[model samples]
Structure formats: structure tokens, C-alpha cells
Target: MRAHLPLRLTRTAAFAAVCVTLAALAHSLGGGTGPDPWAAGVGLAVVFALAMALSGTERSTTTINATLVVTQLGLHELFGGDGSAYVAAHQHGRGLGDALGMLLAHLTATLVTGCWLARGEAALWAMLRRLARRLVLLRPVATAPLPPAAPIAHVRDVPRRLLFRHSVARRGPPLPA
Candidate 1:
């Protein structure tokens, strides 16, 4: 879907396609009540964009992601989450708080996912830097000295002058009467 986008429109168009796909899937799986048809995915995308914009203006992504994750966890626990008894009791419950919680959860997950992906990219960049240092083409031009190589040794017998004496005769043997 994003492949058709020009170099400039590429990112926007891809996100638009994602929003459309998300809306269609959500509607189908949610039995027409999952979320609003045009609003589900696109809304979240907007939320993500907003989150990114907010981060640019205010806090960092890590802080935002952490805040979202904690909020979502609280909401899930409150709603009788995953398989909890409390969540089961509120399966049909409705309130302003619940609505707000749902909104927060969706936004949090989206932003947190984006943050983690950016982090993954950062790690990849660091690895690429290390790799560049190893490759001759990408390595920095430096005049520094190289490290020493491994040493080699050979064993040889020493002459008598260099060796300790093992002889029984002395220099005075010829002069003895």
C-alpha cells in the first residue's frame, strides 16, 4: 500500500492505508461495534501523531511510553482484565471513566509501540557504527599505530661455553703429576 506513495507522500500515504485497513478489520471482527468505521484506526494514527508531536514539544518517548503502559495496566485490572474476576464483573458496565480508560489504553499502546520501534532503530544504528569501524571502506582514516602481533619461539642447544658444566675432568687434570 505504501509502496505506491512518492518519496514525499510515501509515509503519509502508508499511514493512511494502515488506518483504512485497521478500520475495516476492526469493524469486521468487532461485529460493527468495535469502533467507529472511519475513526478506529485513523483516530489512533492521529493519536500517535499527536503523541509524537507532544513528545517533540514536551517529554521524551520513554517517559510517555512508561506512563501509557502503567495507565493501561491499571485500566485492564479495573475492567476485570484478560481473565480477572474484576474485569468479568464489568464486562457490561459503562461509565465515563471506562470510556476514558479505553481511549487512554489505545493511545498508550500506539505511542509505546512507536517508542520501542524507535529504540530498536537506535540499537541498529549503534551496531552499524561498530560494523563500519571494522570495515575498511567505512573505517575512519587514522594514523594510529596498530597493536602487536603474536610471538613465535624456537628451541636450540647451547654450546659448552654457554651451558653449565657437566664434565668430570677439570682444567688441572693435564697438569696432575
Candidate 2:
């Protein structure tokens, strides 16, 4: 358990960093002319790949999605975007409600793409998961501990002797008689 602490922490930190970075990029690109469609597609592809690679389970995917939403909202509040104006001009809304509504609308679209990407990844990695299971299943079995023996009345058997002539038998110390 202790050994896994650093790995978990590293994964968490890295995911957070990516979320923040992506949020900032999204907020920045979402401003002004509302980003080029090509750019948006490329960005979505990057997000899909990142989410698929980092998210291990449904819970993790939910957490990451939440993180992305929250980070984007926070950055939008701090840096301020023209989303309100854009929404009021194009869509039929205004003010904070409009902004939030637009945000939610975009969130739905983004999440759909993410879901598609995750499903694709699941299909692709199914084979990898099976391979992993096979590797574990095929691993060499550890030798069982020898049972304790009663005190020997006679010493006919040598106390220590090589159990087998092959190098494979030397993988561990020889078992006692």
C-alpha cells in the first residue's frame, strides 16, 4: 500500500495539471471569434485522447469531467470571456444565466465526444486487458514453503544438497529435508 502512494499522488497531480491546462485553453479559445472549427476539433481530439488514457474507471471519468467543468468555470470567472455577448448575439439568452446555459450546452457536446472516445478506447484496450490477464496468469508460481519435519533419528540424508542439477532449480534456496 505504501509503495502505491507515490504512484497515486503522481497520477492525481498530473491529471489535475492537465485539467487546468485544458480548461485554460478552452477558456482562451472560447473567447473572441469563438475559435476556429478546425481548432476546436483538434482540441477535442486532444481532450478525448487525454481522457481515455488517464481515466481508468467510470468513477475516474466522472471525476475528471467534473474537474474539467469546474476548472473551466473558475477560469472563465477569473479571466472573463465574451461568452455572454456571443450567447446573446447567436443564442436567445443574456446575462449570467445565458453564460451558464451556454456553458452547460457546450459541456453536453464535449461530454458526448468524450463518451464516444471512451467507448472506442474500451474496444481497443479490451485486447490489452486480456493480454495483461494472460501475462499474470502465465507468471511462474512461487514454491510453497516446506512442511516442518520431525527430528531425524538417523542422518542418512545429507543435511544440504542440490535438489536439482538445472539452473532453474537454483531460483531459490534449496528446501530442507
Candidate 3:
């Protein structure tokens, strides 16, 4: 269980966005009017954020799909407006067609979102694995200690004349132009 804190937080944010957007769209289309859209969006965000945090990284496609489906259903119900209005709408012969349409839309959205998140998860994990491999390969290797430096000869004892002998002769001063 790698601590993918950034990835987890990002996924949480994406999930929240999806939840709020889809729920709001579905609610409006279904003729459900809510008092506060901002409150609904924030509520969805907080709920999904907590869900994602508890669920951890969803690496499996099936798991992602399942999670998304549940989330969509929850959001749909949440934004479905007041119970009295919902009951009145249904009582007035709002048949199965609307319900079916909403379900279908939610399912479609879930599948698409799940596929996208799964693909991204796979790519990110693959990149992380490659980076880990490269880092391991770059580890410093242990080697035998370098040989000690040779001792310097005592140059102070050498005669200065001998050292200077055979040295380059001093150049004469340049002739006047």
C-alpha cells in the first residue's frame, strides 16, 4: 500500500466534481428544484471526499465502476429535491420512462468515469514502477578503498644549484626597434 497521497487527493477532487456536475444536471433535467445548488455541490464534495479517503486507491476497474455507480445513485437521490415534491411528481403519473432514463444516464456516466480513472491509475502506477526501478539501478555501489598516496620525497635536502642546473637560460632584453 504505497502512500499515494497526491493521487488520492486528486482522485477525490475529480470524483467530487463528477458527482456534483452529474447530479445537478440530472436534477434539473428531472424537473427537481433545489433551494441551494451551492450547498448541494459542497455536500456532494464532502461526501465523496470522505468516501474516496476511506476507499483508498481504486486500482481495479471493477472496483472503480462499482464505486462510481454507487456514488451516482447517492448523488441522484440527494439532489432529487424534497420528498413531498418527489411524491407529488410520481403521483401525477410521471411514469417509469423518466426513472429509466435517469438510471441509464447514471450508468453511462459511471462506466465512462470508471474507465478514465482506471486508465489513469494504470499509467501512473506504471510510471512510478519505472521510476523506482531507475532509482534502484542508480544506487551507489560499494568499492574497495583507494590505495594510499605514495610518500613525498624530502625535496628540502636537495641542493638548489642541482635543481636550477639545466634550466632554461634567461632571455636577453629586446633590442631597440
Q: Return the top candidate by TM-score.
A: 3
What's the lDDT for all of these models? 0.45, 0.53, 0.69
Lowest-sum lDDT 10-residue window in model 1: 1-10
Give per-residue CA lDDT, model 2, range 69-108, as digits (tens).
6544554444443557644443444577776787786587
Tell me how far the alpha carbon of residue 160 in candidate 3 is from the true structure, in angstroms, after superposition.
37
Q: Compute the lDDT for candidate 1.
A: 0.45
Quote the lDDT for 104 in model 1: 60
Please, what are the lDDT tens digits per residue for candidate 3 over residues 21-120? Answer: 7666656655556426765866676667765765464468887677777777676666655667765653334578865765677688779877887787
In the order shown, the candidates' Cα RMSDs to the true structure are: 13.5, 16.8, 8.3
Count: clashes, candidate 2: 0
Q: Which ten residues in a row have the lowest lDDT in candidate 2?
A: 1-10
Please give the TM-score that candidate 2 achieves against the real structure.
0.39
Residue 62 displacement in candidate 3 (angstroms): 0.7
What stretches of model 2 exceed 4 Å from their correct place? Answer: 1-14, 33-60, 81-93, 113-131, 142-177
Query: What TM-score does model 3 achieve against the real structure?
Result: 0.64
Candidate 3: worst 10 consecutive residues by lDDT?
86-95
Better model by lDDT: candidate 1 vs candidate 2: 2
Q: Once all C-alphas are superposed, what RMSD does model 1 give against the true structure?
A: 13.5
